[model samples]
Structure formats: C-alpha cells, structure tokens
Target: MVGRADDAVWRPYEDGGSLGWMGTQGGTIARDEDFGGLARLTYELDDSRSFHALSCSVTGWLLYHRFFDNAAAASAAFEEMKPALEALLTQLPEGGPSVPGNARLGGPILAAFTVRYG
Candidate 1:
C-alpha cells in the first residue's frame, strides 16, 4: 500500500504541519481548519531518504523516553499517533509495501499501547 501510495504520491500531510513530506515527491502546504489553532508546524528537509522515517522518528522518541524514565509520556505521545499508525497497519500487511521498516509491528504496538496507556 505504501508503495502504491508512493507510486500515486500519496501524502498524509499535504498541508504544512508538524509532519514532513517524504519520498521523491516535492513538498506542498495544505491547511486543515480542525488543526489550525492547536498545531504548530515546521519543516526542514522535504524528502526522507528512509522509507520509514516517520515511524522511526516516533519510535526513536518513544525509545528515548523509555530509557529516560519517561515511558508514560512516550506512551501518551504514541496515543496521539495511534490512528495514523493503525491506518498504516491496516493499509499494509506482511510482505506489503509498507513493510519498509518495523511499521508492520509498530502499528499494532501503537494501537495496543494507546488503548493500554491512553
């Protein structure tokens, strides 16, 4: 699915936000009224060399928190990203395009962690 999305140039963050655009595609800015007031967005590099950049970034934060006695906060952060993670899991399965990283398991872990800790 991720490969298909990549092929189709599917972008989760068409609008400028906390999330950065990935892959070979050019960057674009979009607006979501629902998130307009609450979110502050910043972008550095538009394309991510690794296919699982977002997943790795979030997981890296979680891991850091886990090692820093901030697991609770990390769990909370995962809760916020749970929806997209789950969606990614549902959209991609084993041997699927999104199997680029630990996303296959990360998605389920995010979902379970959200339910358990959130």
Candidate 2:
C-alpha cells in the first residue's frame, strides 16, 4: 500500500509515472502520471486477492473501479464486493465518494469511485 510522501524514496518509472520500487519486499508506491512532484500514487495492488482493480487519476484524485469478469461473473462479484467496498470507503465522514450521475457514454459501467486518504 502507498503511504504519505515522506514514507519512501520515489523515482520515475513509466512515462509520466513515478514508483517507489520496493522489490517485492513490500510497499511500492507510485505517483500520478503528470510527472510533477505532487503526483498521486499509482499502485497495482491486490492481484491475488480475488479481484482486479482499474485505476485512473482525475483532477488530482485517484479513482478505482473493480471487476471480476464479464456478464454473470461481474454481477456475482459486484454483489459480493459492494458491501465491503462501501463500508470501507463510506466510513469517511466527508460524505464518501459520490456518483455524479453524469457521463459522456451510454449503457452500463461498473461502479467507479475515488478513495481520499488523509
């Protein structure tokens, strides 16, 4: 898991990306793709933990969305994961993340959210 700025020595990795390479020891932190010192961390975590996470940086906040598979599998995962995810994020007193109910596209999308840590 990525910690605060003073937690590790961060360095650039990919294009517009920064990573605090820990070499599997633990805790590899990454910043956003802006190439600025204040970039948000991009973490590829929780691969073996039953779900895959897709993340993006928007307006300085990192957003995460999850899924298991398509069709029936996605439905199943959403049902099982929704409560845990909601409980974890909505615990924030800042009213948690809100769905704007606005998007450019039509059709379906798995729930998307941003986790703002102090």
Report per-prediction Cα RMSD to one decimal: 14.9, 13.9
**lDDT by candidate, in order shown:** 0.32, 0.32
Compose the digit string of candidate 1's lDDT tens values, residues 1-118: 3222223322334343434333222322221111112112222222232111112122121311111123344344434444544343344444532446756555665566445533
- Separately for all candidates shown, the number of backbone clashes (residues 3 or more apart, or on different chains) is 1, 2
lDDT of 2 by residue, 8-116 (tens): 2333436533454432313233322322332322433333454333233322223444433233553444344434333332222231124242231211121323322
Worst 10 residues of 2 by lDDT: 101-110
**Shift in Å, residue 2, candidate 1:** 9.1
lDDT of 2 at 48: 45
Using all chains and alpha carbons, the TM-scores for the candidates as numbered come to 0.21, 0.24
What lDDT is reached at residue 28 by model 2?
35
